[model samples]
Target: MKLVPLGDRVVLKQVEAEETTASGIVLPGQAQEKPQQAEVIAVGPGGIVNGKEVKMEVEVGNTVIYSKYAGTEVKMDGTDYIIVKQEDILAVIK
Candidate 1:
């Protein structure tokens, strides 16, 4: 099933974390940190939110960095996804 975000929500698929350190040390799965980078999968249409006009600044296929603890985790057909608000997205990778 495809995820369709509503309001100002955005759907993202997280990028894979590096398995090796800069020093070339291979880190185990448990030792790897969750990546803050993700690719935008879907974006909700911008509209009035909390009585304030909101406009979407990201789009599908855009890579973005988000807050470390933001968004809700979801699993669909074995694929993991994050659903976060536009405000939670800190920056869009150029």
Candidate 2:
């Protein structure tokens, strides 16, 4: 199964959060923060949305940073993914 985003939406898979701190301290599940970084899996076709012509700047396989609370989570084939509006994506990693 695959996800195909529509209308300025993007599909992504979250990057794994660190289980240990830089100081070598191990963090438990509850102590780990939700990862804001994700890999673009699918991108929507850019078109007129909200009366504005939007062009998609990100492409598939690009790593991106998004708002911490952005997007809706989906589970498929035991894998997790998130669907967010393009605006919610803060930056694309080079």
Name the 10 consecutive residues with the lowest summed lDDT in model 1: 24-33
**lDDT digits (tens) for residues 1-72 of candidate 1:** 799999999999987766565743232333333337789999999799888899999999998888646589
- Candidate that would win on TM-score: 1
Point out where model 1 deviates above 4 Å: 19-35
| Candidate 2 local distance difference test against the native | 0.82
* Residues 1-94 of candidate 2: C-alpha lDDT, one tens digit per residue: 8988889999999877665657432323323333377899999998998889999999999988876466899999999999998998988877
lDDT of 1: 0.83
lDDT of 2 at 2: 92
Candidate 1: give the clashing pairs: none
* Candidate 2 deviant stretches above 4 angstroms: 18-35
